[model samples]
Target: MNSPRLAPPTTWFRMGLHRYLGWEQAVTLAANRLSGFRPVRAVFATASRLGDGIGWYAILLGLAWHDGLVAFQPVGWMLGTALVGLLLYGAIKKLTARPRPCAVCDGIRLSVHPLDKYSFPSGHTLHAVNFSLQLTAYAPELAWLVVPFALLVAASRMVLGLHYLSDVLAGALLGGLLAMLALLAQ
Candidate 1:
């Protein structure tokens, strides 16, 4: 008796990848609807813009200004980790080349312009989580402020129609891992 031939990679992808991408797109579209409300759009738009780097920089500057030399070590650690995260994020984005939800999906409206052309793992979420975790490690007291802001930054990626759920999840997981590794090294 002859054994059955296995399906090719293309066939397997056609059967599974399309379905998964469809589900992701559906969820992304649903989340994008939240941007319809002016208040919601405004809030997330601001969060997304800040997540671009200004917010993190301001936090570091404020800490330094407030605490002077005491803030130097933590600030240095955060900045170093952020630089690593940016390089890794850029490499992955170039490899994946996944288009932003707003670019590919109908009914997904962008609340704010994207900083980059493609989206896979969200850079904003990655930096937010990484920075938040680093802050928590250095100054547990600041968790109350940084944690919520990190969460808002992650949510803003989807609500702003810049990323899918998987992208945000991946970013969070990667960021957390990177933070853990960096903390351990310290």
Candidate 2:
């Protein structure tokens, strides 16, 4: 008997990726539904805005103030890593050209304006996680603050309809990897 024909490798990969994207879009829509509530929307919008870099910058300045000149090393690392992250994420976003959930899905509500046109990996979340990991490593005491802020920033991306779950996950993973590399270099 002849065996059934198998789909090509590229077809199989595309099918899997499409299915994953469908699931991610569903999750993004579900989270975005919560944006209808004014308070919830406000909170996430604020978080998304802060994750734009102001929060991280303030934290860096605080560290410098607290540690004086000693904060130079960690602050330098954070700045460098963040610059790399900015470049990496911008390049990947352009390469992926993934549309924001709000732009693609009918049910997804945009709670905040996106920083860039594409949304493959969340820049807000990338910076949040990067700064949180580096700060917590340098001063464990700041974990209580930075970790929750990072989590908020990540969640806000989806809830605000600026990114899909996959985008946020990719950003977190990339951020974590960058942090690890920075730590190793130190």
The best candidate by TM-score is 2
Give the alpha carbon lDDT tens digit for every residue of 1-186 in model 2. Answer: 999999999999999999997888888889999999999999988888888888889989989999999999999999999999999999999999988878889988887778889988988888888899999999999999999999999999998888888889899999999999999999
User: lDDT for each of the candidates?
Assistant: 0.90, 0.91
Q: Put down candidate 1 lDDT per residue, 1-186, tens digits, no spaces.
A: 999999999999898988998998898888889999999999989888888999989988988998899989878888988988889989999999999988888899988888889898898999999999988887788899899899989999999999999999999988998899888988
TM-score of each: 0.90, 0.95
| Residue runs of model 1 more than 4 Å from their true location after superposition | 1-14
What's model 1's lDDT at 52? 90
How big is the positional error of residue 158 in model 1, measured in Å on the Cα after superposition?
0.9
Candidate 1: Cα lDDT at 107? 91
Q: What's the lDDT for candidate 2?
A: 0.91
Between which residue pairs do clashes occur in model 1? none
| Candidate 1 local Cα displacement, residue 34, angstroms | 0.1
